[model samples]
Target chain A: MATSRGGAIGPALVLHLAVLAIVVVSEIIGLIRVPIGIGAVILLPILYAFALGIIFNPNVLKATGRVLNHDATKLAGTMITIAIMPFIARFGTTVGPQIEKIIAAGPALILQELGNLGTILIAFPVAVFLLRMGREAIGASYSIDREPNLALIADKYGLNSPEGAGAMGVYATGTLIGTFVFALMPPLVHGLGIFDVRALAMSCGVGSGSMLAACTGGLVAAVPDQKDLILALAAASNILTYATGLYAGLFLALPLTEWLYRTCAPADRASTMH
Target chain B: MNNEIAISDAPAEGRAIDLASHAVQLLVVCAVALVGNWVATNVSPLEALPGMACLYAMTIVGLVIAKYMPFYLPSVAWISLVAIIATIPGVPGAAFVNEAVGKLNFLAMATPALAYAGLALTKNEFAIARKSGWKIVIVAICVMFGTYIGSVVIADLVLRITG
Candidate 1:
């Protein structure tokens, strides 16, 4: 029922500009705050867009439906693919001088970077035993979600299948809120000042380029003194996550998650019977 | 000179014109996005316009280089690698562009883009998640929680040992 209109660039641009305007106005009215500098202001736009979409849906301004559909919304996402590298590259410039710091941080930095996998470790068991999900659900829910893993799952299980639905569920959640989580969490954690800033920085590097940028941006803005080091650590850790993540997700994360699911969860027939 | 020839030629001509128009539209969109990025950052238009242009130009050049690489490398990776390499002090033109563009607030640029993503949410996607039931939310929450805890433990331990 909510399928997109596909290539309507004109309507897409108009809707995007409208949402952008709302965000700017909201920021001016002091309805929103960006203590972590200009980067953390992303939440405003999402809020604006979500609100606008809901108000303008079929229940409200029915004529505005075309502007709020999947196609119009996706235009910005496709544009994001373009913006991501430049953001990271600009971030990369700062890393040049921080090489020595990165080397000094060494293995500890790597371990902190490994924190990105914490979700997989925890989710695998929860998905299997607690949720009673099958291998497909466990695999889809366990890793850093992006296109490649989704494709792998789709290849093994048809897009219409239950596995596909599982991937879709997580993918939807990740797409919708992942950036917000990354942007807000670090600064909140850092503001409390419980952990080392470097550890916070390394923790920001959870693979996805956009999230890395968001997390690192908030961390940098929050702890401006360690800006270079934070960004450097984030950039390096992001690269490792991206480089190793696919192999790990498919071969290591998914298989292991599936194994845990089968071993721990009651059989599918049993769960259904319950 | 026949009707058939004119009809076939008209379709071919229309296709070419359509393609050229699409390309122009794309470039215009790129410019608009740059402007949006600049405005969102609260930078003065005078200072930011040229800086945004330069930054975008460099990214385009980086994309071109990535396209020509023998092996398959995503443009984002190549762009970052290229931009980083160019930022070295002695490299001509790199330092200037890096200085100007690097100052542009990344979060500001990302904001509208993400807002666009929010706007993109369709009822269909929502329906699918809903149909899958509350379990999907549970899975999503657990995944997010797991990530947070994992990061905290590893980060704290590493810092303690290293610091």
Candidate 2:
């Protein structure tokens, strides 16, 4: 009895209305700025909206939860990319004003993408040696394991495999809590007061939109006046991630992870290693 | 999983709606973002109406292009391309586009978009995370920090050297 209509104002419409309500409420709640460590952090309306969205989650309560239901919930999730189009457009518009700055960024914008390799370089060792995870570490620490990474892992290794589950672990956590975790980084780094704000902003481009948004939001919160430059750099770096992250993950990171897996996987986990 | 290479695995994009509803849904989100822009940025809704309208139009055109284009580029790419083309320095009406669109804070719009994303999170996604054990959580943090710090260090060194 599923209606299966995309644009129809069905149960999903209720979800839309709920989003509108969150927008109104979170905005009015405004930004809550607090001093933490060396720099300050402002809780953007998005944070409040995210918290409220959790409260309104179908699993947590039966209020709007009941109305959102399964179908409605699925639709809400899909709307994520479309919902952020305006922000993407904003990123686009801002880029034009400072195309020169982007050029001035030299090879850094593209080279920074190499930083994605850091995931396996660091996470792999932690997963293998410290956590003693199995073949799962191969998939888990390979990449950020977003949708594309998940697909790549699934293609190379079936979803039910240990590797697949490992990817899913990181992917699921990324979906559930990645935003908040990445959001906290900018200010903490800013507190150290080492990296230039522009460089830090560029690092906020971690591939995922919400994560990027939260990261850029955090950096701007840490360094306010440079909003323009921060966002433009973030968006540019993020786009490069979208463009190159998959190939890099597929050809480079995963292979490196496999070699590392062979070298460092626990005895029991390494027995049948690929 | 499908062959279509895009960001999220959630659902198909424009295939979900017709032209009219597509336009309507975009408008609705834009309207919500407008309210957010007013509240968070201290700009009146009236003052930013032109900017919202401008963004809305660009979004519509960009989506249309994404739909019709022969290739498989994502909607965001086309939308961003249109916006970038419109506002880039010597383009006609670039200033008007800049000033008008400037009225709306991009972050303001992102608040509502993420609110929708927040509402999108489901119980199943959470269950998967929990079943994975706490070890993965630490791994997730390490991965994120390593990625961020690694990039910051590289970009900082590159920028300083070039400067």
Top candidate when judged by TM-score against the true structure = 2
Instruction: Give the alpha carbon lDDT tens digit for every residue of B76-111 in model 2.
Output: 767777887888889999999999989887778788
Summing lDDT over every window of 10 consecutive residues in candidate 1 chain B, give the lowest-scoring window.
Answer: B1-10
The TM-score values for the models, in the order shown, are 0.78, 0.91
Residue A102 lDDT, candidate 2, scale 0-100: 82
lDDT of 1 by residue, B1-163 (tens): 1111101111122112233332343354445445555556566656766555655565666666655666544455555666566665666876686667665665444444444444455556555555666776667766765665577678678768777
Give me the displacement of residue A17 in model 2, in angstroms: 1.9
Candidate 1 lDDT by residue in tens digits, A1-274: 2222244667656765665564464334322546553333324333443355445543246676665554554454444455354565666665555667777877876666456667777776666667666654654576755555665565666555656667767766666566666667777776666778777777666656656756776676667787777877777666556555666676766677667666666674232201
By DockQ, the best candidate is 2
RMSD of each: 8.4, 3.2
Candidate 2 interface RMSD, angstroms, 1 decimal: 3.0
lDDT of 2 by residue, A12-130 (tens): 67887888889889888876778866776657777788888888988777777668877777767656766788888887788778778988995888787888788877898898888
Off by over 4 Å in 2: A1-10, A270-274, B1-21, B68-71
Q: Candidate 2, fnat value?
A: 0.66
